[model samples]
Target: MRKALAEVGQTYDVVVLGAGAGGMSATVFAALEGMRVLLVERTEYLGGTTAFSAATTWIPLTRHSRAIGADDSREKVSGFLDRAVGNRSPKVLREAFLAAGPEVVETLENKTDVHFRPRPFHPDYLYELEGATSFGRALEPTPFEAGELGADLALIRPPIPEFTILGGMMIDRDDIGHLMKMGKSLKSAVYSARLIGRYYLGKMRHGRDPRLLMGNALIGRMLLTAKKLGVDILTETETTAFVTDKNGVTGVTLRQKGIDKRITVTGGVVLASGGFSRHPKMRTEKLPHPAPEFSPSAPGHTGALHDLAFAAGAHHGTTSAQPCFWAPVSHRRRPDGSMAVFPHFVFDRSKPGIISVGRDGRRFVNESTSYHQFVSAMYATNKDGSHVPTYLIADAKALKTYGMGMIRPGGANIKPYLADGYLTEGATLDELARKLGIDANGLKDSVSRMNAYAKTGVDADFARGTTVYEKANGDPTHGPNPTLGALETAPYYAVKLWPGDIGSAMGLVGDENTRLLREDGSVIEGLYACGNDLQSIMGGVYPGPGITVGPAIVFGAIAARHAAQRAAAARRGEAGQGEAA
Candidate 1:
């Protein structure tokens, strides 16, 4: 139950910081093991960035995959990870993750309200790598009814405003196709009508749509489970410092409502505090030079607790290839004056009739590559920061068919976008290039070359559509090459793209059991880390969808289990001493 700082109990078996996917998982699983748990969040809401995500969890060799007859095994997944990640991360950590992933799924399903279903054909981003499969690893949360949460529904963090439709209705990936084709197909029309009808009815009654999808559903299910297990949840509570003894961390000092309070823990404290993406000092120190100005991460990831962790002898991971995960995002100002940052993930770039270019107005990278790779290419080619703000240009047909940035598919009224200068439009490619302050002749030559590549069904410059992952994100109905088409339609449009990180990758170094480790390699007893708080298991490599959340859940559970076992062992030691006396 959520309580004020003064009302909460002074002691808990385990205290979890940050109520994101990893922290919530640790709370629920710890409670299942008969521990009294306390969950604290710095923000007013429970879900962190997880609430705004697609919630595609990548865990291999689960019952969900087996039920779907997905031809996969430990050997295949290991091989794929071996090639994709190499030695960027420790092999022991990877082995532990693979071994415990399916168990975590099974435990959560059998003992709690948390549930998931496999995506039949979600391919790994590096599908061309050894032993990569086109299906079965990615699992999406089952849709949940917010009504089930009753009065506590308001505590769940809302999805990103740009991601929702009709003010507050959340749409799933499957719902997109139906809504897009509603005008053309009778079946799709019916589906769209019912979905919209339900949304309106629920909104009228509850002041917000009660049906939750994607990350909302995932967090809702976990939140419901945490409540049922009787975990003490406190929001708007900030951790000030770690309370430690000669044995290690024993509790935490928190500031709530401008008053400080100390909460004792017998098991351990798990750090899943969403990492240092928002930390002013850490971002400049750890992130690449010329750091990104915009990020889609949650507001609570200030890395305040990281200082305390470091003071207690914990160190950051050393082997990560990058400090943060990358995405090409577009920004626009809303009517309320808040900036609307949209990450162009798996949507416009991979579709046909679109291309990205540097200031020279020539293609800098393959348009059909993954979002991470696309942004990496931008930075790789941007020696003088010219490509920091590149242009994503699409003709009228492509813009209407696939949507650019925050604009919806088939969006007709773009007056506001043009008025705010979020969008640039011109009658011809040369004109578009001129408006964008790029070399007009270079753009014309580039378009002429692309038109030739389209006719030949090949991207000679960068090989756009050769990968299965790229094709899967493209329009299957398109002929010859799913990701290739000429940008010949008049009234071309463009949006400025910038490097934006979704989350931090380099974090506190920990062992396989989620226990924090010092620089000398000794474990810091009674303290653990997971989620973005823990150094990413993939070593900053974008291997597949849901890699972050998948390990978050697995290691969260591992931390809770290890803490419980330690408490049990301590109890056994005391009992034996009494018997000997």
Candidate 2:
């Protein structure tokens, strides 16, 4: 009835899609099991979101954080995530995510070169929010050198424009700001410099290497590790169709540089090609920005592979997705597509971090919420047809002391946004109100109340002064009552900000095992998805650091592990039915 083994030398245990952390993580474990693994990524680079725009990988509310003096648990973590989607996250997936998170992080640490250190100072978005712990759950990847990547390193995108990796070095979070600080102990200063210098030397030798010492560092390093472990990486390729037989998946039709090719395999297909963030057509019809210009996410997050999977008939949960998280560039864009930071002198003086307001010039929600929520709020508002331009309001002291109102002008120098009306400024509460084109009387009163709270360090309407860190990050020396001073300080600054998103958080649904599924609730044999490409386990909400990459690694590994098991069975005369929970 069936053809015997063809021995075409083309089949293997697993084929991981999207060489980014999500896909790579799955491949790593699968390959570790001694199975032949083939990995495919549409982008020239690997590490998906982690490579292009990952700030941190979140693994909060874990047992480690609690054992280390911070208090938290799965119940609290589940509370936040479930509240976001009203329990839409399937119980199996939720339990699997919680159960496997720590194990996944632990595996990366002991098995491969991926290193993670706890960031204790990084607090939860809402410090007092239930189950919110100050540390433990936030593990930042150590820096790495790009030289280890050898030839493949050049293909991956650097974390951002300024942040580059070279050789095998990896940079961690703790060392970032310390690199610039001046008052460290003599020994500490000398040690930090030597460490940084060593990394620089490595990068120098491996020109254009990634800084594998930090968040992006580990992501890049591990990808190279997976490749070294016999993972076949076919770049610039697309899985156009899922070749199937009576039992399940049989192979895939792939395209490269517009040429069609087919690869028949007995193992499964893991779809980690990422979300629809960069799709020009999807951007126009969905996303808030409505612009086809560059999104920081790596290219090929077009949801094309997703469409193909759906056509093949798979059961999935929610398909509507967006980069549930990300931030707007505070300044403006550089020619190389990076953001320019407004002088710190400005932020230190005044600027309550601008608010991306709707048509009304009022506080919508906590602007300080994680960047993910900011974009989500923006998306939600836009979906309802609300035209909102962000407004950044700051006092004149905010102006003279800091480059308070400035964004990248794509010009030679950073220009004050206020000068070009990209930002609006004025003196006096009423005048400032008039400049913003809002009800001058309403704005004046708003200023009056905001000032009163600033005086007493207590915001009555919005409790802006509640968080000590918020104020600490603000002007601590702003005189008699810091935070208040009546904004009465001559000249005010207000700039408009758009809702910038990191990437969408919806795509092919997967189970706790991270098995890729169809819209109708059937698992597409061998298919798996994670990161922004899978429906967010957090329901498009960011609960903590590494929120994007953390799950990616967890589920990616999960997907690969099962694929390996299935592959081994097919090699034998046994019926290759995958084991399930």
Candidate 3:
């Protein structure tokens, strides 16, 4: 139903679709190799799901680890991958990812504005897994100032507003310690003052402060590096279909501003559209019933590249038992009629005095496990969606100390939350149960049992505070048990949680070279995929923090290098023909 309004005959050495971490990384790498590159994005702003992320990259046995005094080896990481990813993982792909990951980081940091540091205390999601380490495998981007981006700052998508403070001020894990005690301690007060002062100063210069951190920082640096390397970036351009010859894919037909145009590519096309998380048809086919309502992914993500690749004869990869990486999300509808969905990762769950319960008013999970593990329990217990609205119950003291969902710590006013219907409050356990439509007697008995556990600093029912992973997420200062506390306060509170997915698990089939493959296992020359578009190397299991972005960056590098070499070879062949002529 659309018409071609124009055609672009310019042949780029490499054309990258989507501007997420993967696509951006590929563009930067290819440009660094002197390839005539073109980067296109469906959205006006760049940085797909990655911008809203914590921006941690889980890369094992890297130079960063070595610098941090970690003694990890490739063999150990491989053993861990084998045990964690199981038979569903491709051995060659896994090996390639691990091998290329450290190199990618080294090159990026050595050549461009991209920078990272080891998270010395960060642990794998399943720390107890074979060969898993307690630290040094994860790396986070160095925080970047928005002013360094200049005019391009507006084009970098900011972190989720729900993750920010006082409107748009972004803070990282290090800022939490100071913020939690800002009012009580002088040093914390000075730290908070300095942060606020910097934020306001930036606001005075730019309409919004450009003090980018986390995922935004990673993408901001990538964009700047790409620009410096002379990569042409086209925003609001949709790649509708691939232009293929008998030999292989040669270019792409793009629809931009409602006008279709064809752009030739001599190098290759990289598919990194942040997966099919938002596509209705794909959601129907790949996800469970009652499609997920909230995703931390960029709004532009709708699996367009996947559809286009499939139309071009690319085969679907083997599906995972788990089609998506899961997380529990809690939302509050704002006065502007927009809902703010917050993914509960490391903040509130493992904190003392909080428990998650189902419709039957009983604890269904440990409530201190990894987000993926917690959501898995949610699915197993609430089959058929009977527990449409699960509640996270906590007492007044807990709410004041730890906060719930979007509520910040340090005694934030809860009256507004209650008035907006975001929180259910009751003076007593019975009152709260009645309001939440749960069995009052069952909730009472559950609370009594949890209180007993709190007294002894032990969770006999679901082992809430047993694992090192749980304790790591907990408040170490809390006495008795850092993650266990009695709910014996007068006022109790509850917030509803819904199952949400952070990334897709299934995608186009690809080989160790990041080349897309056909049904017969033949490679599609000049076509590559990475990020969520390539079936995750870990299959369905979430091995550790930054797994998604870590492999995304590595394959992005792989795809770019391979395409650049191929294009150079083709150019040489053409030059040879000219000499013969």
Candidate 4:
């Protein structure tokens, strides 16, 4: 049962800060080990950014891999990481994550409600890497029934409004494909009808669709498991400071409902508070110069707990290639007078008939590349901040077929978007360039070159669809090149893209056991870190989908098991002292 801060006990075997994927995993695993665990979330909703993600967990060589006949092994995965990440992160940490990843998956499946199924053909972003595979490395959570949570369903952080359709109907990739073919295929029509029917039926009762998919499903399952394990959950509670002594962190001071309380922890305090992505000072300090004005990351990642961790001697990792994960995002004002920031991840960019260009009206990056790499290319090419707000242009056919940024597919009604200036439209290429304040001659020349490349079925400039990963994201039905098509259709459209970070990469350094380390490389006795709180194992290199969540789960479980062992040792020592006295 959920407990108010006042109702919770004075002490717990484990007190986990943050209710994100990492923190919740630590709480669930600790409780499964017969320990009393308390999960604290600064926000009223749980899940943090995980709930906003697709929840593609990239853990290789598990039972799910075997079931899917994926020929992946530790050696292959390690080689891929070595080539992709080099020595940006510690080898020991990566090795630890690989060793514990499968174990975490197995334990969660056997002991909790958390479950994942292998993605059939999801390719790694860097498919050209030495040991990158085409499938089975990434696992996605199974769809869950939100009704199972009863009234507590509201506690799971809602998906972004832009990600849903028809007033809160969440759909996954498969659903998208089926919905796109709804009128063309009988099978798809039936499938989409049932899906939409169920959504409407559920929304009538719950005010939101009861079917949960993607990150929502993962979090819902974890929340149900936490409830089953009797893990005490306190939401909207702020951890003001870590209560420490000579031995290190022993408790935490919390403020809930404006009432302050200190709770003792016997096992350990696990820090999984997302990261410092939203911290006002840390954003200016850690993020790149000309810091992004907006981010789509969860609001709970304000670095409040990071300050406490820093005071306790924990320091952030510095060897990462980038301090934060990047995504190209577009923003629009909602009816409620709030800004809706949508991260453009694998939606319309890789599809045919689209091209991204800088102020000079010239292409700078491969349009079919991964979102992270695309934004990285933007930064690399944006010496004068011209590429910071690059334009993604698509012709009429492409706009109606694939959609662009915040605009939905089918192009049924775009007047609102145009009237609001969320989308810029032009009847001709020259007109589009003029409206966007770009060199019209350069845009016309770029389009001409793109047309030739489309006819030849090759992108000589950037190789947009050469890799398996790129092709997979592109329209496979398109001939010549899956990701290449001439933007010759009249009535073009464009949306401004901004570099938006989804999560932090640089975080408090921790050991293989998830124990937070001081600046001198010594462990902080009773403090541990996981999720974005710990330095990313991939060294800020986005190797594949779910790279962050994969390590988060592994290290979160590792931290809990280590804490359980420490609690056992402490009990033994106390008993020994009692007997001696």
Task: Sort by TM-score, best first.
Answer: 4, 1, 3, 2
lDDT of 4 by residue, 1-581 (tens): 57788999998878899988898889889988888899999999999999999988988888999999998999999999999998899989998888889889999998888999987898999999999999988999999997988888889899999999998899998899899899999999999999999999998887778899999999999999989888889999999989898868999999999888899988899999999989999999888878999889889999999999999999999999989899999999999998999999987998888999999999998988889989988888997877989999999999999888888888889999999988999999999999999878878887888888888989999988999999988888896999998999999999999999999999999999999999888889889999999999888899899998888888999999999888777778889999999
| Model 4: pairs clashing at backbone N, Cα or C within 3 Å | none
Mind sharing the TM-score for model 4?
0.98
Model 4 lDDT on a 0 to 1 scale: 0.90
Summing lDDT over every window of 10 consecutive residues in candidate 4, give the lowest-scoring window: 438-447
Which regions of candidate 3 fall more than 4 Å away from where they truly are? 1-9
| lDDT of candidate model 3 versus the reference | 0.85
Clashing pairs in 1: none
Between prediction 1 and prediction 3, the one with superior TM-score is: 1
Give the per-residue lDDT of model 2 (tens digit) for 52-160.
5443667755545665776667787766555544454565676677788887877777788777666555555545455555566676766665566676776665555
lDDT of each: 0.89, 0.60, 0.85, 0.90
For model 1, state the Cα shift of residue 481 in Å.
0.9
Candidate 4 runs further than 4 Å off: 578-581
* lDDT accuracy of residue 432 in candidate 2: 66
